[model samples]
Target: MTTQIDRLTTSGWSTCEPIAALVRSRGLPAITREYLLAEFSPETWERAEDATHALAKHFAGARFADEVEYGVLLVPDPHFLDTRRALPTELRGGDVVDERLPAGVALPATRPWQLVVSVIGSYGPSLGSYNEVTASDDFVVLGQDTRQWMTRQVWGARVLQCGATPPDCEHNERWTFTLFPGEELVDGQAESGTVLKGKVRFRLGKPNRGIGSARVAPALLIDVQ
Candidate 1:
């Protein structure tokens, strides 16, 4: 019997060439595409297409102000670390340890889908400024809950210390965080909703004075119907 993976791969709707090209250009492994195909449902692919198209249109003629590397990942499960470990050595750029899920939170049995948009590399001055310009488009709207979670949870946990000795500190090399959908659990209940997850990796060092940054952050405007 032809497996679901085989059917999806041969169905002409498994992969988006433009998106795949972008992912490959950023040095993401082929397995990223594999996961997208095997895990993401058909509806999820449609949303990805819409989000990518909107992002392309938004940045049509804009000059980037940062050296940004971004990729889109559709995770069918909430366990991101497991997904990371399954990646090829070259693609698993860094490791996240001792991460913890929220207490008293119960995830759904049928893994709720997660759309992860990762922005890696250097930002010209600050990520906030970059986001202001790039994510200002109407297509990209961060829900209130999502915004709060990013501020309090994601940014609050600095996996690497990048603020002690200016650019020279080894700890200042990289600062990263993974953003999960806010309100995963609310009012003592878990609801089934398409989760939007974002992973951002910032490379901190001497400010890139005079050298402008290339911005390629892709925002997900998911419309789950």
Candidate 2:
């Protein structure tokens, strides 16, 4: 507990919270140790605030506080065909085989990357529930309520990894994960704001929204870009 150097602060700065203090003590984010480990100084703290805004801008998406309500109590007839409800059974141009197109034969194939979401946060009284899905097919059930809860496009998404593959088939094991700015948020669902695009373990502490991704922690960073 003894120091290498005296602490740097006025009575105000010491008693008053540092800019990144909330981010450090609260919420789930992409913040690495490096992000919070810089020397504490007036200039350094100011720079951190700016860095936080930049990180939010480049990596995170806009949040929507639900002003509008979207849901249907009506269940459509199983026999009824709604044009909007139906989509093309298959998508074109998704496979590597397209690179080998011959002069004669044409194959239409588009495979989807598996979309999996591990429940990172919760609503409706503390950390509400834990849900996990391995494929988009299963996601369909939760998509409606989940989308409504998130209330913004891009899923208000915290991108887990860009094009990386999971180390295992399990959604609870991840190869990579990232935290971004505004992760300092203290609302009921800040922990859930995160999206796991690849396999990773997601666990939450009860009665409060707390998500812990299982496995490795990479060299954490905030992309200045």
Candidate 3:
């Protein structure tokens, strides 16, 4: 019998065809195409496709890695409480840091035109002693340094000093960042389109001590029309 998890996994991988199709249509690099198929979740790929299609009018004739500015946001899955435990170890950490909000916060009904791809995963339990999320050039180009551009904050009310309590003790943490496009003169008019790439790094609590895991999505392409 095919279990629910099995179905989900299979369904996710099934996106390979669409991804491949996008690669061929966009004339994207074969290596980046394979990287996206291998590393990101089905959810990310779906959003990527939507973003690409939506921006087709604006990015026409522009090469993906050479002329497009890509932006990727690592978003916590809103439904994590219901599926976390059952998710594969790799998909577990994208939870919201704010425990105060009730369950069932819906995903945005409409896709934002400016967004490239929102990478979904289990990112929380925010109550960990140490939490860190970083983005770099290996996968994507961050407009600024990891420490400067990345925003980190403690969310929960309870505070536990390091070494005062057990290392396993949990604490709430929230992380955020932004990306911008570069502009140049196009036929004497300002045009936006600068080549870039994106990737993510996440760490919670002590080394190898967190309950969740994360995966880096493909190089996201942002449409700055």
Task: List TM-scores for all candidates, in order.
Answer: 0.34, 0.17, 0.19
Off by over 4 Å in 1: 1-38, 65-71, 75-113, 117-211, 214-216, 221-225
Highest-TM-score candidate = 1
lDDT (tens digit, per residue) of candidate 3 on 109-222: 132111233222212112111122222232223331222211111100000001111111222132321111121112332111111111121112222222222111222333
Task: Give the range of the ten consecutive residues with the poorest summed lDDT in model 3.
Answer: 154-163
Considering summed lDDT, which 10 consecutive residues are worst modelled in model 1?
A: 156-165
- lDDT sort, best first: 1, 3, 2
> Any idea what lDDT model 1 has?
0.30
Tens-digit lDDT string for candidate 2 (1-225): 011112112111122333124223333222223322332234434443443333223222212111111111111111221111111222111111112212211111111111112221121111122221111122122112222222111112111121122221224233222221112222322222222332222212222322333111111111121
Better of 2 and 3 by TM-score: 3
The regions of model 2 sitting more than 4 angstroms off are: 1-182, 192-225
- Tell me the TM-score of model 1: 0.34
Native-to-model Cα distance after best TM-score fit, residue 5 in candidate 3, in Å: 26
- Candidate 2 at 64: error in angstroms? 34
Give the C-alpha miss distance for residue 96 in model 2, angstroms: 27
- Evaluate residue 81 in candidate 3 and report its C-alpha lDDT on the 0 to 100 scale: 16
In angstroms, the error of model 1 at 140 is: 3.2
TM-score of 2: 0.17
